[model samples]
Target: MSPVIQEPAGIFITLEGGEGSGKTTQARRLCDWLTAQGRHVLHTREPGGTLLAERLRSLLLDRSAETIAPETEAWLILAARRQHVDHVIKPALQQGMIVVCDRFSDSTMAYQGYGRGLDLRTLRTMNKWATGKLAPHLTLLFDVPVRLGLSRRRGQRSSQNRLDREATQFHEKVRAGFQTLAKQEPRRMVVLDASLPLESVQRNVTTVITRWLNARRRQPRQR
Candidate 1:
């Protein structure tokens, strides 16, 4: 595959992890922190970010009477992604706004490809087509033990979704898949030990993001 061409006009940051990895919380906090610094940041999430995409997200996550096949699931997510990239992500980037997304392409690779036993290469091709090869400038993968993560979800007050109800082994596969991706692309993907306390994880996240943004600002533009 060709190198991921991150949007040159703006920075795109994505957060990925298994269930209850605290990525959602961290995403919100990061966005708020960035906003306080007067950065033009747009906070969004995959399988969401637009009306159509949110509808698809509901269908994808809701525990329905009808069982969705792996291929069907992959198709729905890709469709949502297409909507998100075209309607939400690209426009923000073109305006030179920092976009902080809760989840993105890596989630599909982990959940649909590895967790659902689909073909990773096929998914990649589809994703490339769907997003026109747009990829994140940075991806933070908050990894936690499968059992602990699942337990955290169960302890949550909110209703559990289909993914939240997945079996232990399934979630294990997803976490492992995320770790593998981080290893494969260390420059773009940073792995965080989410098992740490909330403040510790949040501090690590903000510190890393601040340093990354500073580093990018110092680099000379490519011709």
Candidate 2:
């Protein structure tokens, strides 16, 4: 696919959660629904979106790399976001396409801030610079107990991601981090019960998204 241009006017929706929260599943579902509604949709994932970002993804997710410190890992994530923002996401939105990102800046706060106990101030600063003041129009936080989520992860053999290899406590912290963020930004973030059946969760998600889109459409364009 050709690259999307910079400065899109469309809405950006991000799905955030801990492991096994169905972000990938729901993100794709949302994209398909948007397309069925005749809206231009772009589905992407964090730590990866642009070509360069994918390369960085490999380095960041290599579980065997024991020497990578937490601070370094956070920087790598931010760097990938910088590239993704400038090269892919920003452009897709400029074209007025709905962009469903599997994860975004929230993941950084959850993983690096809460999980790794990094300085939130530094993370926020880096995030602002990387995203160029671009905030998601809406963020769906798939809330689930860390134990259940991590247990589900143990059954998946294909996930060799280093971040996925962290201890259960780390994941618990990540979940707590997302919860904190949701509380702090209730207007922009909606925490959804992810333990429900996929269809049920999807229905709720569709309802919320449809209403948000409809409302946006009804609003008069600002000069």
Best by TM-score: 1
Taken over the whole model, the C-alpha lDDT of each candidate is 0.91, 0.88
Candidate 2: count of backbone clashes, pairs at least 3 residues apart or interchain: 4
Work out the TM-score per prediction.
0.94, 0.92
State candidate 1's TM-score. 0.94
Q: Write the per-residue lDDT of candidate 2 for residues 1-223, one digit (tens) a residue.
A: 9996544588899999999888998998989988998989999999999888998898888877667888988888889999999988988888888889999999999999998999999989989998997889899999988777776777787884676677888998999999999999987899999988889999989998987777777872420
Q: Which candidate has the top score in lDDT?
A: 1
List clash counts for every candidate, in order: 0, 4
Q: Which parts of model 1 are misplaced by more than 4 Å? A: 1-8, 220-223
Cα deviation at 11, candidate 2, in Å, is 0.8
Show model 2 residue runs off by greater than 4 Å: 1-7, 220-223
Question: Over the stretch 1-223, how does candidate 1's per-residue lDDT look in tens digits?
Answer: 9999554588899999999999889999999999999999999998899999999999988987379999999999999999999999999989999999999999999999999999999999999998889999899999999988888889885768988878889999999999889999998999999999999999999999988887877883621
